[model samples]
Target: MSSNDLEICKRFAAERAVLDREFKGNVVVGIGSGSTVVYVTKCIAETITRMNKEAEKDGRKPDLNVTCIPSSFQAKELILRNNLNLGSLESFPLVDWTIDGADEIDSQNNIIKGGGGCHTQEKILASCSKELYIVGDYTKYSPKLGTNWKKGIPIEVIPVSYVAVKRKIECRLGGEVLLRMAVMKAGPVITDNSNFIVDWRFPEGIDNWKDIETTLKMIPGVVEVGLFIKMAIKIYIGNEKDVKIYDFSPSNE
Candidate 1:
């Protein structure tokens, strides 16, 4: 986020994907959580404004009544900052699309998310949407799930039951679960919903992601797990040289 060139390139990938892709009948969009989404929301606002101006010139009303539903508080801030029409999932339950970021992804399109501790909401948005697009730099995609990113899975839990959830994960899921501590604030990091986070990392890393995610979610206090299986319909991978987009059908663009 500082003056890093890589971060800037990622911004291009995020913005370019939304700018280039056609959202023909998409009126309601689910905005996701991450640095990349910051650019995506801005582009949406810009495009909407441009469309409105063009419509006015043609003596017709602006028709792209795009409404953005944010996944988290940070995402909500981005939506408001861009001067876009803000909406909620309750109103727009079935979204046209959802764009999000991933910490790590594999050949099967499985992903490890929630480095931002917003995976709970991120997953919900993706699950609720008709299509989910994963956006990031080329570095995010890996041959194996844990080989590139081994930072562990992020799990949001109820604060009062964090201790029990941590123990359950370590005992049943075979990983070391640590209560996520706040780097900028005192004590544990609290989510927008006022829940606690527990990041679990297996010393050897994960292979059966779906099973692991299911096990973690079975715990009484666990709210959500960071492992995402077969949720993304497409991925936009960007490099300094060029950007590549991959779909679940093994096609590229």
Candidate 2:
């Protein structure tokens, strides 16, 4: 297959594997944002259909009871378009598991998310879920966070304080900070939560991501940083050949 086609197949493979393993009956699921996550929602919808059909064949009520909680506006639309039952964090409060896509996944399982400007809500759902799983293609896996994903760490900040927040991140954190501009709009890209996004291109080969995550969150007007430190239980990285699963360990934490 062509490279693009192969990458898409890899994403499908990883997403299908995640759904087969984690998507069981009567569970609340968190659907995250990004291109790869598109496959996840599709897989879930297919699974639900197959499961309900099986129930009908067995003369049982087709109640899969899988409620999907979206992490962004895009994710919400994906769930609704797929004809899945939609839910809210306020209503569910606790999610059984969450599957998301990552911009980059390091060897330690540290993730760089928010490339879609939905990291704030994504992180909220991840934190609420009992388990957080990531799925991505081979291009997203790396030995370090900045090795592959060159778009920099996405930070959601208040629109009014974006200038000040950008300055602080550049000055204190030592990175080339840039306000993410909108492609179709006139000004900066607005997040689903109506916040602005700042991309912090930090120096490569940094060893202290935990400290950096803490420092970035402490900044005023910062809604959420894309740096996910030790929050993932596992990552399913799909390549042209097969899917590789990385389990989180205490040493990596």
Candidate 3:
């Protein structure tokens, strides 16, 4: 297979494994954004169909009730296209599990998301979830943050405060701040929250992720930071042949 095809196969493998393990019973699930997560929604829909069919065969009521909460507009469309029940944080309040794709995942499982400009809602769903699980191909794995994902840390900021936030992140935080521009539109990319994204090209070899995350969030007008420190309970990394599971352990600290 070609490289892109191989990568897609890996993504499907990892996403399928995660859905098979975590998507069960009557539960609300948070669906994350990104290309890899496309397979996640597909796998979940397939699972639901299979389970309901089994129920029919056994002459039992279809009890595989699963409601999907989307983390972005793209994710919402995916859920609806797949014929899955759509829900919201205001409605579900608490999610049983969240499955997302990360731009990069370090050995500590500290992840950099928001490559799709949906980190704000992604973080919200993650915070509301009882557990967060990430699925990605081998290319996304890294020994540390910034080792693989080079675009920079994605920060969602208020539209009016984007300039100020960019300046602060550059001056105080010491990084190349860039306003993420739109591909088709004329100006900067607008997030689903109507905010703008600033990609902070931070230097590598950083020691503290949690401190930086907190400091970034403390900045006024900053909606959310893409740095997810110690939030994920597990990550399913798909290699060429199979999926590798990374379970977070406090001892790794």
| Top-lDDT structure, candidate number | 3
RMSD of each: 2.4, 2.0, 1.9
Task: Report the number of clashing residue pairs per model.
Answer: 0, 0, 0
Tell me the TM-score of model 1: 0.91
Q: What C-alpha lDDT do the candidate models reach, one value each?
A: 0.83, 0.86, 0.87
Candidate 2 Cα outliers beyond 4 Å, as residue runs: 1-3, 22-24, 249-253
Sorted on lDDT, best first, the list reads: 3, 2, 1
**lDDT tens string, model 3, 107-185?**
8768999999999899999999998888888888999888878899999998999888988888887979899999998
How would you encode candidate 1's per-residue C-alpha lDDT over 49-68 as one tens digit per residue? 88888889999866677889
Q: How many Å off is the CA of 218 in candidate 2?
A: 0.6
TM-score of each: 0.91, 0.93, 0.94
**Runs off by more than 4 Å, candidate 1:** 1-3, 24-26, 249-253
Q: TM-score order of candidates, best first? A: 3, 2, 1
Worst 10 residues of 2 by lDDT: 14-23
